[model samples]
Target: MSNSSLPEERELLRQIARGDESAYTLVFNHYSKQVFNAAMLYLKNTTPAREVVQEVFLKIWLKREAMSDVEDLTGYLFILTRNHIYDSFKKQATQLKAVDNFVQLQPDAIEDTDYRLQERQYDHLLNRAVSSLPPERKKVYIARKEGLSNEEISHKMNISIHTVKKQMQLAVQTVRSFVKQQLHI
Candidate 1:
């Protein structure tokens, strides 16, 4: 953090700690795009990559005072973003595993058309439940499910960043509630 090296990031961190909007913008503009691109390499989706970048910046801003102590800002953000994306992928993989397990447990040769019909019915009901979401929530859910970020969602929908987050939260809560009731999970 000496004046000789990383002076720019140090200054930006200090200003950000003092609630400087311009500093936040500067840091975000400089590093967020890099973070987003890195995330996109793993996530393969703009929305998710954007979300990872926003989450990275949000964490930095919220913990700006401690950012000076961070040995390498770029390295820290890179690791944080990577971990978050990996965690998301893990969760998605778990959900898919459960669905696959359900399919595998069904008696295939014993029960023929009836089982397929029932599975189709379940899928139909799930689709209907998702479609019942409020428009914004549904949009956010689709974007988030596909690994989109708050920034990407906001840009795509032409809305404020905060609004996109709210929509994402609502979508999660609504889906969780519906899943509990429908699947008795």
Candidate 2:
């Protein structure tokens, strides 16, 4: 923990809370790599780790008001970093394209807020459906989606590969079923 980094980080967070772009840029350059590396330690994927880093900074800029109560800026960022990476895992498991450009890259025109609202609603339903899965299934789903290899997941969870695969399959099926039943689509 650099003493310079701590005060600099705290200042950046304060400026960011006021919607200052230069502060965000300065801070992003300073800490993005650390955030990426930390996330990569947990996520172990280049693309998702990068994406999570981008998201964490964006969220920090957007929600910097929470910083006043925070003691350690770096610690707060690490927690946010982990949460976003896990959310990327959930996004991968529940849908697809856990990247920034994917939405803009949608094949058809989604230039409507109402349509976007429905998409968000569907995403909510999907999350609820996932939450409703059995605990083992949810764990497997999160692990796999976070880019953990099946063998890694199996070893970490102390389960057999066969069991991991079965639980994942069951989780997928259950999520799909819940979506269909609840949303009729």
Candidate 3:
């Protein structure tokens, strides 16, 4: 436990509570790397660790008014970091289970040849649809397909995270429509 009475960090918390941007910047500069390291230790991925850092700070900013009451700010921040990492694991597990269930729901009797043909057809249609997207949207779509997080895609593409999400949503809808049309589904 760091000395809670340390004037620098305590004063930073005060300024943050008062909505000081420089104070927020100072806190972020001081703690961002530590948070990222802790997140990486747990999440084991650069993108998700970066996301954890962003989310922790965002939460701090949103809850700044309550900072004065926190005795050990450093400890509080780490608690938030651990909680966020745990939430990420829970979300990932749920997604994996859903994927497992979907796989299990597939017809067991579908022969290899028929499955391979269907897969090839879907791949061809998906490739065609992806190639038709505008350059930036296509990049976002490809990054998402490669399992990059929205934050990672946004950083790589020099765009806002919201834009990454919107572009991905549009790309998915367009591809789904195109594939459905081809399959008469």
Q: Go through the candidates in order and give each one's C-alpha lDDT.
A: 0.80, 0.81, 0.87
Give the clashing pairs for model 2. none
lDDT of 3 at 63: 93
Q: Can you give the TM-score per candidate against the true fold? A: 0.50, 0.45, 0.54
What is residue 91's positional error in candidate 3, in angstroms? 0.6
lDDT of 1 by residue, 20-67 (tens): 889888878777777887898898999888888888888888887776
Worst 10 residues of 2 by lDDT: 1-10
Q: What are the C-alpha RMSDs, in order, of all predicted structures?
A: 30.1, 27.2, 26.9
Tell me the deviation in Å of residue 79 in model 2. Answer: 0.5
> Which residue runs of candidate 3 sit more than 4 Å off their true CA positions?
1-7, 108-185
Model 2 TM-score, all chains together: 0.45
* lDDT by residue (tens digit), candidate 3, 1-185: 23233357877888899899898998888788888888888878999899999999999999989876777877887899999989878999999999998887665545666889989988998999899898999999999989999999999999999999999999999888888888899
lDDT string, candidate 2, 1-185, tens digits: 23237456667677777778888788788778888888889988899889888888888777777755666766777888888877767877766544545776664555566689998999899789889988888999989989999999999999999999999999999988998899667
Model 1: how far is 16 from its true place, Å? 2.0
